[model samples]
Target: KVDQSVVLAGVKMKNPVVVASGTFGFGREYGQFYNLNELGGICCKGLTLHRREGNPSPRIAETPMGILNSVGLQNPGVDAFIAEELPELRTHDLAIIANISGNTPEEYGIMCEKLSAAGVDMIEVNISCPNVKAGGLAYGTKPELAAEVTRMAKAHSTVPVMVKLSPNVTDITEIARAVADAGADALSLINTLRGMRIDVNTHRPILKMNTGGLSGPAVLPVAVRMVWEVANAVDLPILGMGGVAKGADAAQLMLAGASAVAVGTACFADPYAPVKVRDELAALAEMQGISKVSDFTGAVKPW
Candidate 1:
């Protein structure tokens, strides 16, 4: 039998199919479709120190091959999540990863401390949020700022800290190296690429936010390339995510060097995407005469 289990940065996952942040939303709605325990891990919706109202309406726009979102990190706040969501999530057998975004290093540290104490399996730091103290520059766009945030989160959290890297950078590998050196336990890569859609009839932008982060099958190649680059540049385990829709997609990311894969936009199309990917990955592994799915990690052969 093919063993699907994988250990990502010291956090044990039943399988390698994790639901990406923003898409899973604490696994409540999707929980109705299937058993949450059937998957590997769940990276809950992005959380802030305080609850946010998010952006204006028409925040989501459909592109040719993907969707763009400008949700603005709307969440129930960290305190509320710990009080209202953690208890129920703890009952699940899979890993519960808290995805957090903060306006400052201190905010990230504070949330990390609170989430860790609240018993989350790990903290997925979303440095894509604008750093208020840095004059609204995203931490993930700057290597030093990204490292600073990673250090602060690692310092305050008791659980493993996995910094989620943004794809809106010139050199993702440099940012990956920075976080890795700053004590990040693991890394998740290729957070949505910035994009926009326009309506010629109205002569205006399609989304209320004008531009949003693009995610879906359109970004799969970029995700794979970045995952491979980061994996080769740094020695940290990676939770590669972007446009994973099926088992072959997951296998592609794993082969590109992701220790595991996360399904994001695919969930909007199929709530059972994660489970389906997991089963398909196992089947593919068995067919390839591979006994363990983990063997797919970084197994790509380049010419």
Candidate 2:
């Protein structure tokens, strides 16, 4: 039998296939389709200090090979998640990760502290959120800002902190190094790339925000490249994600140095995406005669 376990920042996961945050809404909606415990882990929807109504309608627009979303992190406040959602999530045996977004560094620290005290397995700091304080430039776009947020978050949380990097930056590896140096225990990348679409006849943008994050099979290459670069740049473990839709895609990411893989857009297309990726990874590992999944980490051979 193959061992698909993955140890991310000292947390042992049953497998290396975690459902990406924002894609899986606390696992309640998908739980009706299948058992949530079968996957490696679940990163719940992005949480904020207060509940948000999210952006206006038409927040989602379908692209050629992906979808653009300006959902704007609509979620019940963190307090509600702890009181109502976390309990239902605890019923599952998989690792529970809380993904938090903030408009300021202080909010990030506060959320981290709350999640730590709440007994969450890990806290993923979403630095990619457009900084409301900085005129909308995302914190993850700048290495210094990313590092500062990571440090603030790490100082407040006792649980392991993972910094989720945005792909909209000039050099993602630079931001990755910054977070790693700021004491981030682990990393997850890359967030959706910024994109836009215009209505041909209306001569207007498709999304209400005029622009949104693009996620799907189209971003796979970019994700793989960034993961490979960051894997070589930082000592922290990485939860590679972007456009994972199948087992083969997950395997490609693993070979490129992803300690684990997260499914996002694929889940939107199919609820069973995460479980299927895990199952496919197991079969591939067995075929390769590998017993442990971690063996694939940084296993890629250079040309």
lDDT leader: 1
lDDT of 2 by residue, 1-303 (tens): 988999999889989999998898999888886898898899999899999888787999998899888888889999999999998898899999999988788999999999889889999999875322331246888888888899999999999999998888888888998888889999998888889999999999998888888999999999999999999998989999989998889988989889999999998778988889999988998998989878999999999
What TM-score does candidate 1 get on C-alpha atoms? 0.97
- The clash numbers for all candidates, in the given order, read 0, 0
lDDT of 1 by residue, 1-303 (tens): 999999998999989999999898988887776799998999999898999888888888998799988888888999999999889889999999999988789999999999999999999998764212231237888899889999999999999999999788888999999999999999998888888899999999998878888899999999999999999999999999989998999999999999999999999888988889999999999999999999999999989
> Where is model 1 poorest over a 10-residue stretch in terms of lDDT?
128-137
Where model 1 places Cα greater than 4 Å from the true spot, the runs are 129-137
Q: What lDDT, from 0 to 1, does candidate 2 have?
A: 0.88
Each prediction's TM-score versus the true structure = 0.97, 0.97
**lDDT of candidate 1?**
0.89
